[model samples]
Target: MPNTASALELDAYLRLSRASLGEWLAAIRKISGCRDMACRLHNGGGPVGALSALESEQGFIVCIYASQGMDLTGCRTSDPVVLVPLGGEPQIARQGGRWQPLGKLIVARPEDRFHLRLPELGRVMIMRPRTDILNNLVNSNAGLPIAECHELIDCYLRRSLFFRDHNHARQMTSELFCRLGRIAREESKSGCDCSGLDRRLLRAVDKIRHEPDWDFNLTELASYAGVSERNLYYLMKRDAGITPYRLYQRNRLTRVRYRLVDCQCMVPHISRYAADEGFSHLGRFAALYREHFGELPSETAQWRRNLLEAESGHSEEPLAAP
Candidate 1:
């Protein structure tokens, strides 16, 4: 595919290729609100023929494929891609980051370029905007705030990566697409103003990100924002689509994930991190960590160690006789 090809041009190629695997085109059409959607499959093998999509306004195009042990270069795009490990493992390279194991629900943002080596048969999904419709939706300065819009984009990308099965995946993707379209339509028509609320929410988010070690209670946060607790909750829910507590948890866990995977923090030491983040009970923290990340805190720490060493060009070392 040419580096400068439009998303529509890419979609055309996918439709005309036989190597296209998985059920995504239909899902894209249903969710994205694109009327003239079409796909063709070319199975003439050698490596599955690449699939791409053109940017549109109504929605984005997504591509899902399963492949065994192939090297992919220039997997980068101007839009984000959500990569999930449907089966087996793959190594992902982005920016200065080394080839780390492709875990479930990895949202690869556009700022980072990507290359991948599928060590075993694996599945991946690529999603991009319907340029025309999206532009229409964001036509006005007040229709969709850039930060809020980016968050929504990131959220949708995350959802697409975790899609477990075709039926469920399709339904969820369609719903998200429609919801996004509705938001755009409403904003375009209403000329709404959310700057004050958006600023407050972003300030709260920044507080959490920078001060993960602070014990942040709702009352204190409300005081900081100079709003009533009820109003704060409403604002957070409206802007972030989650409760304050959950958002705090998400923020902390995001930090924890980074420390585990990038910083190689020890398992026991994680409790200290959690405590600093306001986790009073070790057991509860462990449980929540496992639930959110689908692995024990200890395991994540260990995975980080292994990943770091591999990236540094060191021989694999067994964990100290656990």
Candidate 2:
């Protein structure tokens, strides 16, 4: 494996400079496979900065972005991703939830959507790995040291560039896998587990997350999960502290909210969005949406409209005499 300088010489390296927020978001969409992605500038001035992406032959994609302050919203990748902040203040939230500090190596799951707020002169690294590697990281919560991970990333980039001897690159890859295995064993001992639920429950939950519009009854969900209704109820209670029906409703509400708040959505009607997610009863849907998101569905739609108006430098208020 060669150093960063040598790795940058690879053909797959892509760099953009003085790019607008729209251009940056477009590049990010291509790399992240995110849907409904949008960005809002926070710095008044253009988010003039540099963004680069490198793709390795082994299915590892690394994106490094440095820019002025902005807020970005998007769905996560179809697979999991690893996010690392190199500099400046950045915060992230999922499903319109509370924002948390983002200057750490965090795993963003596929089923989640992300709202990232990046500060002025922010630098962040987002990496997508092969499915097996990502699954291992998710299960293990490796909590690997930043320096060690950074060193390995450089090595992996070097290998992707074919910068060194073939045997050397193979050795680096093998060593990286072996280290992850050891970390998994250690984290399991320390009880740093994530989603220790049964495989059947995961199967059931995945179905609900991916198909939130489906009106699944307990029996049907249990059948799909390969568990008895009673057992499934117990599993959901123990694992998520919520009933299966509640889980389904949560996903349904999330889908409805997503549609309502989507910046690109032409029809911002709350009722239409609710019905799209199988919520036919307007009153009930509004109540559920309020209870789940702490805001009515109409409020969500209004917020998006306000954001768009602000982005377009428009205001309905009358102008004062000059």
Candidate 3:
């Protein structure tokens, strides 16, 4: 069995504190493919910076940079970049537009040129999607409606940053791509407003997603959202397409799926793993799991084992008797 059993572990391709600004810049440039990228640190001459990069299985590279501040320029790349701010005031703009503060997220297309300026202690994530993913999006005419889907993107980013699961990250990136493609094909439009109940709903949803195993109720959730129980329930139904209780159940189910896929042991542990996620009723849990994931927990475990074997260059076929 794999030693790392938990799915909430932080796994990254590269995570370290750069000893010098030059080293930090080099690390950023190396991952971002921005050859001429330059940065002038605002926090005096000597400061160590934090940097981390995680590459999804689909080749999406997400790099996080943090320091006191910096004025960055000279990154003229044709790739589409998704900039998400983690903390402090970080701003970026294209050539023809004024600097725009990082509100929720920013999606820069290929034709745009990014000029970034961070004047305080700021942390931001820069994402570069796989080339084939971009090509497929363009070919399918989805044209990256990710900006309109900021809520979903925000949720994805929150989950990714909080849990730091590569498998979950990869699954989410592909799902986001498919969702954007679907959104582009739709003629009608509907979305969540960032103000009022919708925003509160998102907060409650985030809490549930972050701590899915917690026994949360309507009163507690309403208090968390700073709204009345009626409003919270109404908003959760309208914005998230599910009631709060169902949302919690779904998140718990999703976690079970991740654990099943990540664990390398055999299928008999499915019931135990399901029980670990607070599902005491084994048969009902199995039914819900199958309905949610389109496969049984046992099947998922078997699939994971097969995948690992394939990746390790092992075979199921037996050798001839000698």
lDDT of each: 0.49, 0.59, 0.59
Q: Which runs of model 2 end up more than 4 angstroms from their true locations?
A: 1-12, 141-182, 185-322
Candidate 1 differs from the real structure by a C-alpha RMSD in angstroms, to one decimal, of 16.4
Candidate 2 RMSD computed on C-alpha atoms after optimal superposition onto the true structure: 18.3
lDDT of 1 by residue, 1-322 (tens): 2211111122211221222222223223333233233332232233332233223333345443433345555455554544544335756788857888875445465566666655423445444435544454445345444444444544654333223223333455455555555555654222233334466666676676567567768888887777789988898777655677766775576555444433333334877777766677989988877665445667756644553454455745633211
Per-residue lDDT tens digits for candidate 2, residues 1-322, read: 1112111222123233445565455546655667577777776666445444444333444444445677778757788787777667788898779989886777788677887877766766676666666676777654555555555554444333322222333444455544544454454222222334588988787787666457778888899999999999898777655678776776677666545534344456778777877889999988877665445766655544543443455755322110
TM-score of 2: 0.46
> 143-258 in candidate 3: lDDT tens per residue?
54555555655555444422323344457666655554455455323243433436787788778867756786889989998999998888866754467787677667766766
- Looking at model 3, residue 24 earns an lDDT score of 52
CA RMSD, predictions in order: 16.4, 18.3, 11.4
Per-residue lDDT value at 96 in model 3: 56
lDDT of 3: 0.59
TM-score of each: 0.41, 0.46, 0.48
Candidate order by decreasing TM-score: 3, 2, 1
